[model samples]
Target chain A: MSNANAALAQAQSGAVQRYGFTLGCALLGLFLFTGCQSGGQTSDDKAAPVYEEGQSLTMEGTLIDTRCYPLNKDVNRGLDHERPEGFVKACATACANQGFPVAILRGGETDGEVWVLMTVPAVLADYMAEEIRVQGTVRSTGVLIPERVETFSDGEWLTVL
Target chain B: MKTIFSLMLAAFLFVGFTSEKTNQVTVKGKLIDTKCYGMMHDNHTNDHMVKKGDKMMKMPSCATACAGMGIPVGVLEDSKPGNDVHVVIAPAGTFAEHMDKEVRITGEAPYAGSIMPGKVEVKNDKGKWVEVEVAGMM
Candidate 1:
């Protein structure tokens, strides 16, 4: 094989290994939460899936890590609501880097559900703690599989996807 | 000309990569499944909203069930009345033990978002929030 081919093969292997490791950790998270699933969906999970593909959703809120979002439960934990503009960006950015799934906290009246990013973890991680607009499909599992992600930086809509 | 184009590309990539950071913090709240909490308690019309003497009784059980189904568990901090936020807890061995229970964890916090816990604590029988050992440290 050519040197270039050998390098490409090595890179692909590394990526696959990383992806497997992350997926393993996420699945392990599932196991820790459930123990061993004996059957179908849990009783509480019976509610129909809210997310749908091709559904147009424009949300303005901080990007967050899925695991920690509900646990804290305080929307203004790092951002001061009084100011509404104050936020600690480092926290969200680091949280995603730690292998947690990135999600969006939709601002306004919809306080109940958070948009879980099912598409690209790395791309969404960049906008942590920063307000942005997301357009995507909502999977039955309540995850937002994004098709387009944009952030208003310096009055410009910067598209991440 | 090639160098100019390369520099422009590098600048664009730099902007893309440079815009990121995360915060570290210590927090306390009840651990519950996202689906259960959002669909149940958050939605007043939902049947799970059944209240007994002003408290929702089914929350704990529902949270436990959802957690078992591989759903992510999060901490609900109600410190600020109207601004309640959910921070998803990373599942470690000790996490399952504290499912649907109150916990105090110290880790990286993003503004008002999730936590990548460095240390976690759960209340013991005596009612003290003592640190518990997790299989892995996030």
Candidate 2:
């Protein structure tokens, strides 16, 4: 073959090899990214932990009224909540007194999971908005049957119920 | 004899550790507000008391109102005052209108006192069980 033709063919072969290498790397990167995304459980997945019935769990979180928390996480995840009238704010204790479900805002996070307490709501009225530690059995449905509950007060943990 | 005893002990421990399986049960009872029942204990009626100004008065259909406001509703098994109360975890307003009605709930009993209901049926005036539509939780 002529010298110029041989050189042109050699250059074209190198370019093709480089393009193949780049495409292979891109496909591998895409596969790895998708694999990582599906490996971690999302918040909507119900079988995240696959908890057994009566499985014991101990968690620390803030006490919150379940009724209003879902309405407004920032406004109702505390001692006070916005009333249905849209013009009045009410205390969570009064709501709990009227038999609203009280739940624990896990890790005090507004975006975290809120597990409803299976115990008496009226008894928890006094401890609203406090940081609570609960030792209990958790249902697969995510409700907590609290066996022992304590509150963080004055730099110490005190048993409340 | 010693080997047999060791095997038996191991089997007992394995069964004890893994025996807490989820149980599906059907419970029949009257739906009651858990708050009132938990506080008063003896107040099992459908009507509850509310304070108006300085006086406490009976509020008719209070159980329905309370259940509508996201209060946990429980099933008083056999409609008895002192029987086992199984608290149901469901959508907020699912049991609002069914207060004080005879209900049959088929669900998973994660524990002794809590139910995750799959189907709930109430007895109509004609004495027939009718399934109620449950709202989907967000």
Candidate 3:
């Protein structure tokens, strides 16, 4: 009777140890994940810094073409380069995926407008030169059309320098 | 012992993550040179004719008349003489109220063909230089 009681006591202790080990592993994994990328929002995921309004006045970014390259030329007349069909949608999707918008600056020259863009403003639909530096970390919530035509379709519509 | 270990790990993570910083960028350039020059100039140059005429008339408004349409039109400001003033702007709405004037615009340097604007700087109503467009544009 004494031996059996001792055996039972030992088994209970063993079970407790195993449970605790499992719990410890789980807790450690949670801690590690908190600092990792796929985990919930952490300080690492903080958005880009914001810019002040009416600050030192110059900003730039890539010149995004809003035109979709159509397989058929008949519809291309009114399409031109500027007011293309899916330009808005492509930039929006790219912005969402990248977690930022594209920022660009326009020079004063009419013929040779330079497009030097900074990241984070990639998603915006419209921007002007002086306005770029003033507004920082502002994800422009504007219009974006269908997704299909904006991203993958390529027709060489607008040329950017 | 186990509690101490977990606490230590938590502390380490907090320190590392809290130190992370965000990015704010600064960009600068003149809009004088870009590939979309042709379209931006054309739209502003003959916007009146494009809106009023039944036919699509380009600058000089003579093309429409030569096409046998004799459409009444208004002349936008002539583009700057020197190539140095050549800058491209975006779609028609970028210039706000002043978008129609092709003669001499001193406002935001709009991206010519971009669906979105990269930067904006134009003369305000007070006549002082500002980065944004003052009036509502469609």
Candidate 4:
């Protein structure tokens, strides 16, 4: 009878050990999977730092033709070029209509940053060289893909709906 | 652990340097206000366009107005179909007086397209291309 009791006790202990080992393996697998997945996600997020397509941006500034701005035609020697006459609305409109890419000149601390504006020429040409409000997307190359344009009138920016 | 850290550092440095590469190039082209140039192309038929007696005008006054009013000026490398490319000039202030004129530019070529100026030359009223001395164009 004592032998039988001892045999039964041994069998129970063996079963518990096996079950514990299996449980530990499963828990370890779950932990490893979760850890790797989270790690992969973080890596992917940092791999590329670029603007997403069609990301919306709104800005206020003067419209311009990218062709006739500061550096003129001497892009290589831009510092040596001279533009004495300031922003010309007529010329901006004409250039924008003639298929030159338009842009907005944003006032910065030291200089104005030109955000290349892209949209239907006919629509944007009317506001060329004008101080207007615009809403658009930031293209990967830092171009502004305007979806809406507005003008400041009577202390309010009226949307061109 | 030390070996693993060294391998990781090596990989990071490789990516940091290889990801960004710049190229230098020299381009010869006309520096013109893209607007006035295009109006000339359109035959100056409409009043809304820059015109001299219903013709596209290369008048400096028209070009100057456009540049001052925030018009971007660019270099038109070639007008040939399928080969024509215009690059918008940065720091538009430096080229203010050279609108609708021919100029030589040296600068960085974008990875795929257009050149940005580091140095510029424009023709004087005497038709001599003179290297301009600009102070802090940007």
Candidate 5:
């Protein structure tokens, strides 16, 4: 064979080889990029624990009638209300039975934070003015989605509802 | 070309982040008693009927009474079965009087199936939306 023809063939072979290498690298890079995208999506699906919001919390407080409590914290924070004769006094249990928002007045202080209990009020009416502990998630500020509720009675914590 | 591509990518990322951070939702529906609705479903009406000792007795839905009693109120977007009932996080009796009435609530949905209402408006008799003052809302 002629040297020019042989050199020309060698050059063409080297170009084809380089083109193949470039194509192969591009394909590999594409596969890796797609794999990373899918992997990232899966990780996002199995999201990390959310600590800032939807945090599980346990709070101890006193059961109060949310309706009347806001009207008069001192007068309505307890089970009973003071009223003149012939005028029926409003009580926490009555308000609860009437389906008023029942809340846990933290520490039983009139000035304490009120966490509205997201539960059946009639079920909780019996425990009004009683010390209780609620375990659940805080959906928002002062709103508790109770998982379990226990009332302090007779020197012990009893699961009431 | 590279700069333009980078700018477009950055803008998309910004939009994604902003949307992810937006958790506020507004829902308009009829308020119903959560317990009775759970027990009665579509059968839930302004009142309910129960068999008391072999005698079927009709009774009021008592939704307002239940709300005053501390039962969480549920809002049904429609009567369609399998539809979600959004629980309103507000003073128990706040929505009591508006039970079975159409209401529009705006609030943050911190979790699924719940709304921490910031504004609650009920549709009046004249078809006007009236905002009800939510008591004890922190």
Candidate 6:
């Protein structure tokens, strides 16, 4: 045992059988990759947790306008019952002849800042692509008109989040 | 310098031993040109069931790439567990070099915005990779 200690005891038993065959092939390749990736992943790769129990949404607050000026439901809430002293110049001339823009998104604490209108592409007036998540439900519309805006019960200026 | 430091370590080991394959979307043909599950019905959601047309494409990750690749899968009905179809296997080679010919798969399209398009890889108009067999609908 003197040939450089028999080549350091055969390189320490060939590094313990190559580290026990690379730790038994990395624990049998991590148990065949978690039994073949639990039915091929998806749904956050099998973490699967998105319980949307029958709609039920209305968390927290902020969505108001009982006379707050931070609502821009695309302006104009100044109808003229035969103008009495030209109220605010007849709501700024019916918000510049019905192209209004002041603020609207009825029933939701409005003091400032909060947007939830997710999708609205019917009959168009701009509003598509919504899903701000965290308990969803958004419906508030107010449009002034002569052809379609009967306080929009179904005129659909798009706004049905 | 030592041959410009061994030619910059052989161009950094030839860009780290080259291995980056992209351009793999294979679909040649046959899995019964896909269209299964109540095969078309519901023009405006009138509902008779069996819904989904325009070439069905979706299924448990295409049945895990067609399990043991004897490749030929298209289901909207059978193998019920949670009905949501789309599966087109036989890509990325080795099912006997994609069995009976014609392959053109190009890759990169994992249901972009999800109207339902989990995977689609087929090519062959000189784009190569023409070995398809995934039709249960588009």
Q: Which candidate has the highest TM-score of all?
A: 5
Candidate 1 lDDT, A1-161, residue by residue in tens: 69999999999999977766665565555544443342234444565344443466666666765544544557532322212234544655555555456767777223545666644344555666677788865433345546688888998889987
Q: Give the TM-score (0 to 1) of chain B in model 2.
A: 0.76
Q: Which parts of model 6 have CA positions greater than 4 angstroms off?
A: A1-11, A18-23, A38-125, A130-161, B1-108, B112-138
Using all chains and alpha carbons, the TM-scores for the candidates as numbered come to: 0.38, 0.48, 0.25, 0.37, 0.52, 0.23
What local lDDT score does residue A129 receive in model 1, on the 0 to 100 scale? Answer: 67
- iRMS values for every prediction: 20.8, 17.5, 14.5, 11.6, 10.5, 22.5
Query: Which portion of correct inter-chain contacts appears in model 1?
Result: 0.04
A50: Cα error in model 5, Å: 18
TM-score of chain B of 5: 0.82
If both were scored by DockQ, which would come out higher, candidate 4 or candidate 6?
4
In the range A90-125, model 3's lDDT, one tens digit per residue, is 433332233222223233223323332222222333
lDDT at position B130, candidate 6: 41
lDDT of 2 by residue, A1-161 (tens): 69999999999998877766665555555545544554553443645456564688899999987656755788888787766666334567875776656778889988776777866577888998889999987643356768899999899999998
Cα RMSD, each candidate = 23.7, 15.2, 17.8, 14.9, 12.8, 20.3
lDDT of 6 by residue, A1-161 (tens): 59999999999988977766665565555545554554364444456323231233433222221121222223322222122332243333332222211122323332222322121112112211111122342221121111111122243332323
Q: Which candidate comes out best when scored by DockQ?
A: 5
Candidate 4 root-mean-square deviation in Å: 14.9
Q: How do all the candidates rank in terms of TM-score, highest first?
A: 5, 2, 1, 4, 3, 6
Flag the better candidate by lDDT, 1 or 2: 2
State the DockQ of every prediction: 0.03, 0.04, 0.04, 0.05, 0.17, 0.02
TM-scores of the first chain across all predictions? Answer: 0.53, 0.69, 0.32, 0.52, 0.62, 0.22
Q: How well is candidate 6 docked (DockQ)?
A: 0.02
For the second chain, the TM-scores of the candidates in order are 0.59, 0.76, 0.26, 0.56, 0.82, 0.24
